[model samples]
Target chain A: MDMIRRTVLKSAGATGVVAGLLATGMLKPTLAYADDWNKAAFEAKNMDGALDGIGAKGAADNKDLLVKAPEIAENGAVVPVDVTSNIPNTTSIAFLIAKNPSPLAAQFEFSNGAVADVSVRLKFAETSIVRVVAKADGKFYSAQREVKVTAGGCGG
Target chain B: MADPMKIRAQMKGDVAEVRVLMSHAMETGTRKEADGKLVPAHHIQNMTVALNGKTVIAGQIAGSVSKNPVFGFKVKGAKAGDKVAVSWIDNKGDKRTDEAAVA
Candidate 1:
């Protein structure tokens, strides 16, 4: 707990210093880390509730995003997935596993000057809802897929 | 050892793509260990994602899933200059969350 707080504080200080420099014209130009979000607040018992908590709206009817997951997980330990979008100027990406002790599995930021892409590994407690949240132009959007696990992977 | 789930996502045009690999035992706690002790139930309850503080996608999970699951999805209407945040809380009362920016 203390360690987390210290880390947060240090990051805050660094951000403040950078902001000050930018304001004083001491720095040329660069992107900024978002300060208006918290990662621990949106967990829920189900999928829709979690989305509502994070202010995400699914574009299920939209044709811009594509998501894929295994129909049946051979083992309840590791499942692979992939998602791709044809949307222009993607700003952020993330993943979550519902049914695990922690719904939040992973997060990754993309370089503004680089392609909007991210990849990561996460732990799942069981077969659950997997969600990916994306932000573009200050708006929130997301995609979802279901995965099945066969064996016990966590304690093995 | 088995391979952990590998997940990846990319955004193009007006969509936010995402993916995940899940690692878990999904133990129902119905079985006993060698010592005859019943294992406790541990699983993920729910997960959610927000773009720029707005929740866009969510998932509901169950025990029927095998250990280590993989899932993927897409979010439409996304563009550049935004932030994506992901968070989850499990049945065991543990929670973890992280955020990424879109480009």
Candidate 2:
């Protein structure tokens, strides 16, 4: 633990120097390391809007895209969801919840021979269908599974 | 500034299984404080995973993700001792990057 903390501190210091360089314009910011945050999709109020934001509104349903999640969750704050896409040339995967205030949860773009399987922890506002969408060969495919949350993740 | 992420990478046959646990508050603006004041949204906005300095996965997320988010991924063509780096930039412009070697 001590070693880990020390390492963290060392990295933090290094980042601090990097930040300083960036602030002083010594290091030019490059687009290579930056990715655009999908604002329209993430802030969408409904699932359909979220789907549209990600250009998956009319995505075809495919069984090859598998969504594995608990059927019932006691706590909505941290529900584990796993996705695997068997589609050939799969390039990206996205998660959308039907009942969250903003339905879009996350989206991941894969490349360079990465596997199309991922596991992530998400929050569900209530009972909702968690949708997984995969983009392959310029086409989109999706799958969904329902999860019942006894306790709400979003606090009132 | 944010806490460092915990990353683990292991060779599972021909693939490298990488798991990352990030420390974050992930506070949504909807939630209120004890005094009933709405908490400002603070969460990870974007993340990237790199293998030996090459990006393999790029992600964008929202506050709907749970606090201290955990994620797992699989990378192909990776061998033991190869570097795997994971980094994220949050809504508040806070960022953290951590790396691990496939074992």
DockQ of predictions, in order shown = 0.06, 0.45
lDDT of 1 by residue, A40-88 (tens): 3333445555555555646333346566667667654556555555466
- What's the TM-score of chain B for every model shown? 0.72, 0.97
Model 1: per-residue Cα lDDT at residue B69: 47
Candidate 1 CAPRI classification by DockQ: incorrect
As a TM-score, model 1 comes out at: 0.43
Candidate 2: C-alpha RMSD to true structure equals 8.9
Tens digit of lDDT per residue, candidate 2, span A1-156?
344334334434754654553464423233223237777788889989999999998999998998899998988899999999999999999999999999999999999868999999999988899999999999999999999887545432
Off by over 4 Å in 2: A1-35, A152-156
Instruction: Give the whole-model CA lDDT for all candidates, comma-separated.
Output: 0.53, 0.86
Candidate 2 lDDT score relative to the true structure: 0.86
What ranges in model 1 sit over 4 Å off?
A: A1-39, A42-54, A57-61, A152-156, B1-103
